[model samples]
Structures are given as C-alpha cells and as structure tokens.
Target: MAAAQGVRGCLLRGPLRARLGRGCSSGAPVRQQQQQALVAAPAPAQELPSTRRKGFLTEHAAPFSAFLTDNFGRQHNYLRISLTEKCNLRCQYCMPEEGVQLTPKSELLTTQEIITLARLFVKEGVDKIRLTGGEPLIRPDVVDIVAQLYKLEGLQTIAVTTNGINLARLLPRLKEAGLDAINISLDTLVPAKFEFIVRRKGFHKVMEGINKAVELGYNPVKVNCVVMRGLNEDELLDFVALTKNQPLDVRFIEYMPFDGNKWNFKKMVSYKEMLDTVRQRWPDLEKLPCEASSTAKAYKVPDFQGQISFITSMSEHFCGSCNRLRITADGNLKVCLFGNSEVSLRDHLRSGASEDKLVQIIGEAVGRKKKQHAGMFNISQMKNRPMILIGG
Candidate 1:
C-alpha cells in the first residue's frame, strides 16, 4: 500500500516537473520539493459567502475555479460610478420629463459596497474615479462614500459631476471627504432661458452652488454646457463670459443621444462650429495639452482667468482614447456610453463572490468592450437607456 501511494505521488510530480522543466526538481531537498509542490498547485477555490452571492447568476454553483480574465491587455483605467438615478431638474437634452423610472433606494449600492468595489478597482490598476449620477449630490451619503473611497490605495484622483442644485449644501462635506474637483452642468447663463432648458427655476441655486464650490477651494470647477442649435446655443458668449472673473473651466459638450430627448441631426452642434464661434470672439485662443484620459480637447485664452474645452462627441468622436468604464446605480457595468449591453456586477456581488472573483468578472466585462462608440450623434442604433441611468 505504501509503494502504491508513492507511485501515485510520483505520477503527480512527473507532470509538474515536465511543466516546470528545470525550474522544479523532485531530487531537491524535502523542504524545497514541498515548496515547489505548493507552487505547482493552484490556490484552493473557496465558495463565496451565500449572502454575498445571493443576486449572482452562479449562486448555486461552486465558487469559480478560474477567476482572472485576459491580463490587463486592454487597459481602460478610468471608472465612473453613478450614485443615484434621481435628479432634481429635467434638462431638455438630459431628461425630457420629470418622472422617469428611478432605481429603488434599496437597489442602489450601499456606501460600504461602493467603498469595497472602489478598493477592488484600485487594486486592479484603476487610477481615476469619478462620481456621477442623475445628480450625485442628491444621494444623501455621497460625502461618506467619497470619504471611504479616499482611503483606497491606488486611486490618484476623485471627481464628481453634479447638476449643482445641491452643491452649496454638499461642497464643504465633499471637500472634507477628499473630493478633488467638481463638474457642474450649466447650459445657459440667462435665468429664464436656463429655466426653459432645465425646466427648473433654481438657476440662482446652481450659481450659488458654483460660487460656494469655488469658495471651498475646488480648483478648476468645470461648467458643462450641452451646446444645442437654436436652443441655448445663442447663450454661447454668455456662457464664455463665466470665465472672465472666475476660475471656472467652461466646457461645451456636443449633445448625444440616449434619453427620449428631441435630438435631431440638424440641431447637433459640431466641434468646428463651436471652435469658430469661440475664435471669432477670442482669436487668441490657444490649445492646451491635456491629461491622457481627458475626453475634452482643452484650450486657454491669453491672459484669461479660466479655460474652455470642447467635447467633440458629435463631430470628432474621442472613442479611441476612451478609457472609462461606467457602473450604473444598480451595479451594471457599462463599457461604452453608446452600448446597450451590461455586465451585472450586482448579481455577482450579491452572490458570495470573493474579491479576486469579482476582479475577474470585471476584467472579462472590459475585455468585450467595443472599439468605438456609434458614429457622431448617430441615434438610430442608440440604446433606450437614458443618460440619467448611465453615469455622466
């Protein structure tokens, strides 16, 4: 019986030895042989907790034996996590109506869950995290979530994109929570026109929020404007005027299709048109070098207090340089803003998946990412999911 046991062990060692070649040897010291055997064997597959895997597809199955997907070959390092699906205002381009299918409060990720996921993402080489939402500030505990995310090891910067309705109330807390910067969505400077576009009379509130954000030392507070033809397009110069005395970085975004908005082809604002308009006003506008993951082609005017950026999503798509992966309010991982498909992380997390398993799932999801988004403002093949449901 002992001879038979020895034979079985020898058979196992034979295959491992062949695989390792000269790197492993059975004739080595007993301690060294044992070490090689341990290295040859894969880590034991432990089942994820039942509670954690509850919502996952493989709940009844044994824990996944192989977790890592393709190595970080397709390195998309930016992540955008939507905190909520409820916004205060209904911008004509963002949301046409007030009542949309908001994700139930219970379905949203808890602050703890968000922090855990952020840590996991950072560990997997994600360097930047941006908090977005229907309005990120609308989420009551956004500050706490941001604070928790700050504790992550590998994250380099954290930003929030908000509607600015609640910025005044949340700015201090957000800064305290280690928020690096903010992007406030402001389409028009005229109060009545702003009310017309956003369908809200709280323009002053948003402006106040921007002012308060500046006061709290948030540098480069960006003002995002969706330049739509014949709508608030006439307010182009007025929007530019915002940069005169303030440190605001005003960005003009070409309207894209997603929501049930009145997105007509003719109404689309091209990057060329926006550049021409800006140059006609300020010919001294010069191009500025931007960070690797920045979607916008940033520019600065000579002796100006602030800068301007053009996001040519409609005219000159930046999908090639796109490094963002969006996590929806309910935990669906989206690889592209234009794609309809999603990888359900909520299901996996609810299932008792281990951190390593979750990382593999994410890597798999990202591996299948499309090479580019749908062509410039091509809405025919667009997904029915609204932008609010997708993080900005």
Candidate 2:
C-alpha cells in the first residue's frame, strides 16, 4: 500500500520536481523525498504589521507642538502685548476725559520681564507678537524693546500699534530694531475733524508719520480708523480714497462699549452700512481675504494701490476664530478682550513663581477662555475697566 502511494506521488511530481531542485525518479523513496522537500520549504515571508512599521523611526515623525489652552484647544498663534496704559490722544471712542487710572510704573512689566514672557510664549508656539499701547511709542525704550523682541527664537513677526504721534522721530530706530510692520491709528483725514475725534491737533504730524512710514518701506502701513456714527463716519470714502494713490491699508473699526470711551450703542456704526456706503460710489470695490486672526475684512478697488479693511468688532463679532491672548502693561493675562476675569502674572512672578509655573498659569487662563465676549452693551455686568486699561 505504501509503495502504491509513493508511485502516485511520483506521478504528481513528474514535471515540477526539477524546478525545486531534488530527486526526479517515480518510486516510493522518490515520493518520500518529495514529501520531505515540501516539509522543508520555508513559508512565504509575512508583511511587517502596520503597528510595527509605525514604531519604526523612519515611518513616524514628531508632531508640531502648539500652545494649548485649558480646554485642550489650540489657538491661532498671535499675541498682542500692551506696552503702556497711557496715550496722548483722547479719542472719544477710546478714552474718557479723566483718563483711566494709569497702571503704576512699579507694577508695569519691565522690558526684560516682557521679553522673558515673550520668549516663553514663543517657545510654546506663539508665532506673531504685536506691541500695542495707549500709545506704544510713548515708552522711553521702545527701540530697545523692539530690538530685544526681535531676538526671540521662533518669533516670525513683531509689530507696533501706535497713534503715529511720535512715529516720524522713532520710525528709523523702530525699523532698525526689526519691527516688521506698524499700525497707526488715524481716524480722520480732515485736520479739524482729526482734532475733534482724537481731541488732539496733530493731523499733519500723523500724516507725516504715515508718509514717512510709506517712504521708509513700511509695507502695508495700516491706518486704523474707528467709525463713530456722528463722528468721522462721513469721512469713510475720504479715508478709502487714500488707498487709491498710496500703498496704505486703511481699516475702519466699529465703536465698542468700554470704560475708556463710555461706548454707547447709539453711536455705533454697523460694518454693513459702512461697506454699502463705499460700494455706492466705488462700484468696483472688491472684498479681499484676510489672515485667520485678522480683525479686519479687507477690500480694494480695481487699479487701486491702497486697501480698505472693516473691523466689525461690535456689529459683527469674530470670536469663534479668536487666536489672540493679551498681556496688559501690568502683566495680567487677559484671555478675552471683554473678559473681566484676569490672571495676575505680575503677582505670580513677584511671588516667586517659576517659569514653568507661569507657563502653566497661562495655559490655565487660556483654558478658561469664553467662546464669545458678552456684548458690553447687552450685558448689564459692566467691567468698568476701559479700553485703555484693557489695551485696546
């Protein structure tokens, strides 16, 4: 019976055995040899599992780490740090007659302190930083501050938002210090109207600063215009026309309610009305896309060198995409613009909080971020802290 089975196996292997390289006769011993050959053959190599491949360094790369807020969310990577709570102009929509209490000089963060905090923020994924102020240009050592901030690693851009009163004298020094851009607040183009709106008589100075900024190659020099109903709202087109000849970016911001300006809803100008007014005359105006965290919705007319931007903070809230974390001159971390709640980094730092502890505190503050600002006009709960105090 064994011999017959071997002969049957040899018949089956008649043509295939030569390729496998072995005995090729048709007999019982040959059949047994073929069976041994089959048993000795290695199984086809199985593929390396995906999990094992992922574990290999060549297949898996490190992920980019971001400054995560308390709610386990990542932000838009921008920080606006206010240099002071003082300003030379008294724009009715921004500050009151009896100016808001100035943050004590002792309490204010020193340049070194600010730079340290900025470096830490950059380490944790803050890519852009804008130095703001009641007027940042008022700070005595602004040039040094800008130069120092420029040295922070991972910091892609550094800018200053000023009233442009002192820009002409400091423009060269500021530009030399690595300031990437400037946003000058000039609400009115008319000399008399400018004084009425800002309560200061320096229209020519502001214009000169704007012109100098342009001449010095301050790309996209932004002119921030706050549109108040009875105020300079009439000059909307006049301001927009500036963009036709120059390479300026003129932005009109909606008036907001805060302690500084005593914001009233009646005086507010809706962004829609402003846009409609412009489109009425400049029928060829086109809306332009802005960056993710940009407060303004930009637009430009055909064949124009200048651009217009509308910041509808009051009429059109863009809170869902808010990526800004503000540090008041006093060093308090404010997560939201209208938020009354604050985390005192000054107190923590003075209390001997380690750098890691300060970072953790910032993370917690960001975690408690409100999804949207409770409209200052709608909510009866007044913060009493004006825009100047909050670093508008």
Candidate 3:
C-alpha cells in the first residue's frame, strides 16, 4: 500500500489550509494541493535502516575515526550548533506572531557537553563549526562559547549567524574570542517594514552592528536576506546594490514553508527571478566559483566592493554536494535542514555513551540523510520544526 501510494503518503496535508485561515495569499490554494501531492518517495530497500537504538552505532561505527559520509557518499565536515533556541525578535516567517513555547533550559546542552561533542567531531575530521541559534547572542554565555570553541584543536573556522540585535554591543568581545566569520540576518532596508517583519524596532541598531563588523575587519561580513513576494521582493535590486560600495556578501534566500509561517508559493521569489532582475540592472554581473558543499549559488558584480549570493534552497535544490550536519539546542542531530528526521545525541552523551559510541551514533545519523529536501513546490510535506527551533 505504501509503495502504491508512493511519496504522497508522507505528506501532512489536510489540516494546513484550514490552519492557514485567510492569511495565505493568492497563489496558496493552488500550491496547497500540488505541494502535498509531491511528497518524498519511500526509501530504497538497500538504504540504511531507520533504527535509532543505542547499540546500532556501537556495532557499525566507521573505521579510523573518519568524518561522516552519508549513503550518497558526500563527506560531512561542517557542523551547525544551535546554542539556544531563544530569540529577542519574532520574525513573521520564523514563528507565529504570538510567539512559540520556549524550550526549558534544563533540556538544552550545557557548555561542557557542546564542547565535548564539538571536540569529538573535530577529532573525526570535522574542520569547521558555525554557531547558530534563535539568536546565539541571546545566551548570556555566548562569548564564552565562542572563546571555548576557538580553543579546540583541528577546528579551523568558528562562525556565527546572528540577527544583529545584540551584536553591536558584543563585537569587541566576539572579535577577541577568535571568531572567524559573521553572517547577519537582515530582511529589509526599510525601518518600518523591518520592525513589522521582525516584530522589533532595532533596524538602525542592526545596521550599526553590520557596520561595526565591517569596520572591525571581519572580512566579507555576509548579510542574509529572505526575499518574500508581497514582503521584501521589490528590494531584490536594492539588496544587490548594497554590494556596489561596501564589502557585504548579501544573500537572498527564497521563502520556505514551516509549521507556523503560513508559507505559500506566492511568497517565494525564485533564484532565477532574483538573478534576472539583478542582471537586467547590471549586465556585467559575473558568476563566482562556489565550493562543492556551498548552498548559495554565488555571483559578483564587476567593480563592486562585495558579492551577492543566492541560497536557492527552494527553487534549485543543492543537496547533491551538501556537507552540513545540524545539532539543535536540545541536542538532536538533523542531517538535512528540510526533513523532520532527527536523532538525539544528548540522550546518549548524558547516558555515559563513550567517545567511540558517540562516533557510531554520528555515523548512523549521517547514513540516514535524504537525497534532497522535498523541492520548493513540494515543501508542504516538510513540516519540520520552525526555523527558530532548527537554528537560524
């Protein structure tokens, strides 16, 4: 029956429309049915088992403490650690306007545990780690977290993705802590619209933080902007123009669906659309070479001080070269950003799982990664945790 029904069986469809109320825009109704029908197909029989028992990892651990490689043979070295799932701002796309139930502090990973897990991954050939959160800086000890991750051996890069609310004040301490890169999330240039979208009144402060990051010599201070149709879509060229003078790698991400965002296809402005708009304005825009595992389809405007990137996770899926593994604040490992599948490392670590045992768990988790996220059109099936709970 499952095979007969195929991928559509995995979708969470019926309740979405009723839940969306009158909030969804014009094209949502068409997408609602079409997206649901595009759910993920069943896994192949030869694929890794869906088992999550404690002993599974201990038995099938890979040799020589190598880095994680999924069934598709993609090597994983980059790790995104969600320090905490708490934020000061309430962005429209990230969560409900009324806000989400915050996770209790006791359930989250402690600083020591985070370090231990990070050290294990580093030892297993993981070279880079990026700290993320509902807003990483919200945690009182975020600077300390950066300070500690910097001290780990074999970990080459220490980066953070912040909303820039608390960033301006913490710039000095963060720079001193050996932080390597900073990615700020700023969706709009209009102060009023910014406040309306983020549900906060600190647009100037975030801009100040971006300036401080650039001024302090944080090379290529990347600014991430999520472009939605009715919302900030008109600012596509405006965002691109930011690169004309300053050294900002402005990234435009297509709007994605989640549990509470009331996401509809009408909201997303595709990568091709965004690029064409920019190209029409600046015909000399040149494509930049991207690393194998990069999610963004990067490009640079000739003679411009900085570059512009497109994280086309929606329209153009980049899963073929994916090399990332995410650890939620509460210690669950998510191999893919769009899928709901996860394994809890916190349970094993706290249960006295040895380093070897932990490595086994990591390997098993990576083995279960999906080929790609349900593409943009089929994203209603991706009813995973909201972006806030999943980090960034």
Error of 2 at 275 (Å): 0.4
RMSD of each: 14.1, 22.3, 13.0
Name the top TM-score candidate: 3
**Tens-digit lDDT track of model 3 for 68-103:** 655555557678999988898999999887787878
- Candidates 1 and 3 compared by TM-score, better number: 3
- Poorest lDDT segment (10 consecutive residues) of candidate 3: 19-28
Clashes found in each candidate (C-alpha, N, C closer than 3 A): 10, 3, 0
Task: Report lDDT (CA) for all predictions.
Answer: 0.69, 0.71, 0.76
> Which of the two, 1 or 3, has more lDDT?
3
lDDT of 2 by residue, 1-392 (tens): 12112222222211122222112111112234433332221122223343442232121111112223223232435678999988888878778877677867999998888998887776665556889878899999999998998776556567888889999999888887777778889888788988888888889999889998988876678998888888789999998889888888898998878765666788888999999999999998998865444578989998999889899887778776676788999998888888888988888888888976776677667757766778746642566467777776
Question: What ranking of all candidate models by lDDT puts the best one first?
Answer: 3, 2, 1
TM-score of each model, paired residue for residue: 0.80, 0.82, 0.83
By TM-score: ranked, best first: 3, 2, 1
Error of 3 at 92 (Å): 0.8
